[model samples]
Target: MDNQHVDAWKDMIYPALISKKEELEMLGYEQATPEDVWKCLSVKVWKGEPEKRLHEMVQDIFHLKSSVYLSYLTIQSYENDDLAASVEALLGNTENKES
Candidate 1:
């Protein structure tokens, strides 16, 4: 994939994975073990497709929306500058204002 698609993938996949990781941590996992976490997430992402499940797992869990979008970005990167910035800004604002 091209740099833009790679960035898009980073934007979407990181948040989702981080969200899921937080959820899992809240459930008392203590720490994020790649095998356990990835396995659980893979199951959720693939939705029981045996053949294409692995590929789908990575794509769904890490690709965000679809690889097709990445392919599009590969050709001519997306233009959503503010799409993922809000979350970071919110976190930053919260940290600065925290007690």
Candidate 2:
């Protein structure tokens, strides 16, 4: 994946991990280290394309309540930005065609 996609993935995962750390530990991951958790989650994200991974992350965050809605908001913001860019591109193409 590109750096931008990797960075966006990090932005989603890090906050969720930080907020869910205690819960994860309580759920039988107590012996696992931070890097271990990171590696596990990173692999899950890497298994899919960037957008699919992001959607899965957002759903996980919503269900996990990992960051108490923070992670969900972060992903939603990114989705909204993507939507806006798509809309702008479509509009620009239409204008160019008209011109």
Candidate 3:
């Protein structure tokens, strides 16, 4: 995956990203943002890309399905909850030791 390619295409793809974000929101993902949409595609849709071209990226964004994005959000939410629980458990252990 080439970060350079993604960076180079960022400006050109902004509108498409925004459109995807809006689509997600209309489907009830109000927290959706352009970054989230891009990340989901980069991870799920692109899936270890050699680096997609601008047009391909824009097309992917435009065609992204709500179900796929919803699944991504659900998994992400669970992962974030797990991380928070782990942190709380670690903090609880530290407090117990201090006491």
Candidate 4:
């Protein structure tokens, strides 16, 4: 789906996202945000799916399991951490060679 279609649902689904985020917060994910909840859904639950119905999207948000969200976060952290590590290693090498 195009971004325009998704963007149209942002306002409509934001409350659901916030509610989901709050649920996450109560479960110890205190830093959770609507954006994070949305990302969790989009990347993990809706990955590679074509065209999501509004009810389907809402149900996915409401029914989202903590385990799934946590798994997504863990995977994302590892992927991101790997990139940061690689950049730091490269910069370290450059600085060492300069010295």
lDDT of 4 by residue, 36-98 (tens): 888888788777654666776778899999999899899989999999999999999999999
Better of 2 and 3 by TM-score: 3
What C-alpha RMSD separates each model from the true structure? 15.4, 13.9, 2.8, 3.0
Model 3 misplaced regions, further than 4 Å? 1-4
Which regions of candidate 2 are displaced past 4 Å? Answer: 1-6, 52-56, 61-99
How well is each residue in 1-99 modelled by candidate 2, as lDDT tens digits? 333344367555666656565566665546434444454444443444344455566445435533433343456579899999999999999999999
**lDDT at residue 19 of model 4 (Cα atoms):** 92
Error (Å) of candidate 2 at residue 13 is: 4.1
Per-residue error for 74 in candidate 3, Å, reads 0.9
Which clashing pairs does model 1 show? none
Please give each candidate's TM-score: 0.29, 0.38, 0.88, 0.86
Q: Name the regions of candidate 1 deviating beyond 4 angstroms.
A: 1-11, 33-36, 43-99
Q: Model 3: per-residue lDDT, tens digit, 5-71?
A: 5556778799999988888888888999998988898777877654667677777888899988988
Error of 1 at 82 (Å): 47
lDDT score at residue 52, model 4, on the 0-100 scale: 62
Largest lDDT belongs to which candidate? 4
The lDDT values for all models are: 0.46, 0.55, 0.83, 0.84
- What range of 10 consecutive residues in model 4 has the weakest lDDT sum? 1-10
| 3 or 4, greater by lDDT | 4
The best candidate in terms of TM-score: 3
